[model samples]
Target: MIDQANKLREMIRKKAETEKKTKHQIKVYSIVSGKGGVGKTNFSVNLAIKFQQMGKRVLILDADIGMSNANILMGIETPRTLLDLLKDDLILKDIIAKGPYKVDLISGGADLFYLEKLDDKKQHEILSNLAELDEYDILIIDNGAGISKQSLTFTILADEIILVTTPEPTALTDAYRVLKAVSTYELKNKIKVVINQVPDMDTGDYAYNKLFKTSEQFLKIDLEKLGYIFSDIRVNKAIMEQLPITIINPNALASTNISQIAEAILGDKEYNYNVSNLKQFKNKLIRLFG
Candidate 1:
């Protein structure tokens, strides 16, 4: 028993040393929703593409688990996925596939059901590999919809959480429930809302008002409006072709809206996107998950 324990300690030390060598800070942003089919996957892919266009090394992790679709929307065939990394001893760099705008993509393949049952050693391995992805300027996690413990963990673990919803009443109600749950954990401040599929700015504002007012009154959370994506048929056409709207129609309204979101996220003073503090930011994340 003593020999086994000593061996485990040495293995853990080696893993830690390997992680320190790649010391970098990855801005983890998780795009999630209360319900599905609100264009969550589309938003995540486009945002990552837009960021890449802005000269950032981006990695998009499809965290939708059972219903992963980022790769399908982007129209890329991935040989390996997050599942492969979790199931094997592969490093993050080994599994990442290149996507549009040179973005790195990792699919959270359908076999993630096994992830929930992973033992402590496996869990530590996964986290250690993720921690080594510090080479990326940003790691966008497109999480599964609804309020599962798994999804919530992703949201809370991210540096920022963007909630996507349509203007429909049901969508608004579901988003509110998500915000409320986030508030219970004091995560309301880190949350941002993006209104998708709106008819016009007036309708978008109308939808935002419903969520804005309720959050102000009930949850006391000031939700930031990350911007709105206008309804566009071109989006559907682009998706059918497995292309990002930014690539197919960069001038389109939806693409423009998503670009603005990328700018806002990059320019936000609170996020400290400056190059000077990149090392500091990385250290903070290390301390966070250490």
Candidate 2:
């Protein structure tokens, strides 16, 4: 028994050493919309691909609950999903799929009814697994619309919250609602806006300025403008092909705009797009899973 105890202590020490050597590379960014059909999923997919292009290891989590569309946008068929991870006792590596630009994708399938009933044990396990995903340079959580508890929780926990909206009044109202809800957590510093599907820069600026003023005056939220993507038909074509616009048509206006937005995001010291430590985490994961 004494020998066994000594072995266990050595094992614990080795594990601690591995974790200490494992650099932190994961940055969770939750992309949410005020309304549906605002191209939120498209933006999320392209942003993930852009990060991958910049040589960062990225994992895109489709956190949209019952109506996940990341798989559709990426044009890949996911055999397993977040449901399998939560329900079937499956490992993280088994459920993650590879997409365009080498982006890792995980689908949030229709089995999200259990989210509300999650017990402390399940919540703890989920968060533990999430923290262990140090292999990813960034984890993008594409959340569902209309201020659900899951969406709010994701936004609150994320290192950054990207609110996407169009020039439509309804979309703007919904964006404000989400901003206000997130402000309740005092996370205004982490919030940023992306005006999608706008006709031009002037219109996008108008929409962003309106939200910025309202958030400052009413919600006391200091929102930053990340940039905008134009309303381009090529986005729809790329979605139909199950490819990111950056891969399908990199020279398209929307694609160029998306890349610029990505650059702006990386410019922020808080976002941390550097990939020097991703290789270390990947090596650790390979060892642990092998």
Candidate 3:
């Protein structure tokens, strides 16, 4: 698998060298759930670490509205948040918090003013600054669960959405509900599923098939599989310690699954999420939230 990955990466490199210098593709993925307590943020944080390991400049935008905590999960301290940008006119570069593995983090900071009263001029200022900081290769939005307006907005605008759920009955039911909600947004192909906390590959396959078959039969949408994370004690331990499990215990079952998932995503390059500039990407988000 390592050799295959190396050859694939080499092919990508040669292809890139021969092609003209177009803008770097910045992929945005919204990791969401039907309800809370399903390990969505944990997956996002570890996934960021995996992407960083793969040599991609990864950023975690804890845009989960009232429940944002990518910094907390990574044991990071950012002196600033989105509020700093709105209130004190802080640049996007200034408010960004650095997390483990040097993954850049941006707090949602969705205070009343940020949620409802941020003026267009200030929005443009922050976005323009963000456009200048486009060194990142991927931005993952750890969005809040369910059909909240903010969550839906983030998922809809993202280049792709990864809907997470466990194998429990209630969780699977809610996962389906979230998928139904995302269907309203009409980015069917961009939606993927991640079955978390499975006991084994059989359980994972069953969970994924349950949802996949349901979505196909009822919603008529073909959801792709991003892969699954097994139930691992190291996951809970790392969460309590506020560290990425992959960093703390790479040999853990969940970490191994996440690593493979990240590699699979990197190897699939059929989609290009190029933002002409960072300001342009900001405009897309602003349109969703403004």
Which prediction has the highest lDDT against the true structure? Answer: 1
In model 3, the Cα lDDT at residue 237 comes to 89
For each predicted model, how many residue pairs clash, with residues at least 3 apart or on different chains? 0, 1, 2
Candidate 2 lDDT, tens digit per residue, 89-204? Answer: 77678788877568988876765435345676665455445446766778898999878877886655566788999999999999999998888876545478899999988999
TM-score of each: 0.84, 0.84, 0.86
Sequence-dependent TM-score of model 1: 0.84
Worst 10 residues of 2 by lDDT: 281-290
Off by over 4 Å in 1: 1-23, 86-89, 111-113, 273-290
Quantify all predictions' global Cα lDDT against the true fold.
0.80, 0.79, 0.78
Per-residue CA lDDT of model 3 for 100-164, tens digit only, reads 58798987756512644667786666655654545788889888877787777776567778888
State the RMSD for candidate 1: 6.6
lDDT for 126 in candidate 2 is 50
Worst 10 residues of 1 by lDDT: 273-282
Candidate 2 accuracy as lDDT: 0.79
